[model samples]
Every structure is written in C-alpha cells, then in structure tokens.
Target: PDECPLAACVNILAPCRSVYRWQGKVENTTEIPLLIKTTRACYAALAARLLQLHPYEVPEIIAVPLVAGLPAYLTWVATEVLSSP
Candidate 1:
C-alpha cells in the first residue's frame, strides 16, 4: 500500500478471485489487485517501491507497455507524468 499510494496515481482497486495449483495442491484466493494508471516514467519508481513494501517474497509486478491508445488520452497520460524539463 505504501509503495503505490492513491496520491501516486489514478489507481483502480480490483477484487480478483484466483484459482491456481501450487505445491501439488489446488488453491483458491481472493486478492485485491491494484490497477495503477501512471506514466511510463513512473514504472521504475513504482516497481522499486512495491519491492520495498510488498509482503510477498516475489511480488507480482507486471507491466504491459501501451502500444495504442486514444490520442487525447495518451497525451493526458504523458502530461500527467512527464517531469519538467
């Protein structure tokens, strides 16, 4: 939570019910997944923060690069995250 605070970006908290096999056993769990919408620039910082605070030995930190987006929306995302030159 401290890693990616609400103030860090426009975050969406999603409840995820997951079922998977681990240690030769089927497991089911409900997890709170955070959908964080921030700029590419913030990715590294955010990931580092997550590593520092995440309880899991290996946290699930995955980033899908934005290949296509609405022009206006893309511009807004860039504007929101770009550092001042």
Candidate 2:
C-alpha cells in the first residue's frame, strides 16, 4: 500500500510499441502506459501533477468514463480518492 493523494491507484503497464505522427514526421517508439484510477474531483490535480513530472513535451492524458463497474470496487475507489492524504 502507498499514499497517493491525487489518485486512488495507478498501474504502470508494460511498455509497448507506439507509432504516431509528430512534428510533420512519422515516429515509432516504445512507451509505458499508466492506468490511473481516480475520482472526477481529483482528475485535474492528477493531470497537472503528471504534466509537471512527465518529460515528454506532449504526453497522452485522457480519461475514459467507466460505463460500469462492480459496486463495491467503485465505492472503494471513490472512498480512497476522497480520503485525507
């Protein structure tokens, strides 16, 4: 267990190959993705912190609304994110 004030949890996924166009050129790179679990209330802060810490000029940061989740799990996440740091 760890103290994460801005997010309930974060999963550092395995690195994967990425291909995209940037600065008018196609690029291929290996990137590590992060799966973050946080409440809407904490999203802004989390994103800001990531931007401050991330080395990349343009990092991929997006939120996908959960369509459905186990009720108990969802409540736990919300509680964790809202609890005092």
Candidate 3:
C-alpha cells in the first residue's frame, strides 16, 4: 500500500485572489489552493465529507471535467480511492 493518506493528493501552483463584500465593504485576498483528484463514484461522498470539515460559510467545491486524458491514468483515478490499505 502507498503511504499517502488519500488515494490521490496533488499540489499545483495555483495563485488566486478574490474580492468580496464582507462587512459592507469590499475585501480582497490572495491564497494558495489544494487540488484534489477523485472519481465520480466518490465525488458525492467526498463533497459531503468536505462540507462537514470545511469552515467557509460558502465553500468553493468545483469540478472541472476532463476533456481528454491518458487511458491508464484515468483508470487509476477511477479505482484509486476504493483501494484497500
């Protein structure tokens, strides 16, 4: 078994900044991001689980569909989460 705590944990160079009204005033901030890769079978469970753990009032949970990918890598992603430790 792998030493990873999750099936797949990826770190990408994502630099972001968002502007929002907090207390009747606009505020902006920059932050790093964590990109999680999970399968369709596990998406619902993962989203629900994250909602419970996340502290954001309206957390951002976005899924970007893959237009194309290597067959073997895609297969690995589909089954990785279900792998037994």
Which numbered prediction scores highest in lDDT against the true structure?
A: 2
Candidate number of the best TM-score = 2
**lDDT rank, highest first?**
2, 3, 1
Question: What digit string (tens of lDDT, one per residue) describes model 3 on residues 9-76?
Answer: 56655788878787799879875566887766666777776678678776777877778889999888
How many collisions per candidate?
A: 0, 0, 0
For residue 41, model 1's alpha carbon misses the true position, in angstroms, by 2.8
lDDT of 2 by residue, 15-78 (tens): 9999999999999999999999988888887888889889998899999999999999999888
Q: List the residue pairs that clash in candidate 3.
A: none
- Candidate 1 per-residue lDDT, tens place, 1-85, comes to 3433422354657778878777799979887787666566677776777788788777788887778889888777666663323
Better of 1 and 3 by lDDT: 3
How big is the positional error of residue 37 in model 3, measured in Å on the Cα after superposition?
A: 1.0
lDDT of 2 at 75: 93
After TM-score superposition, the amount by which residue 53's alpha carbon in candidate 1 deviates from its true location, in angstroms, is 2.6
lDDT of the candidates, in the order given? 0.67, 0.85, 0.69
For each candidate, what TM-score against the reference? 0.64, 0.86, 0.70
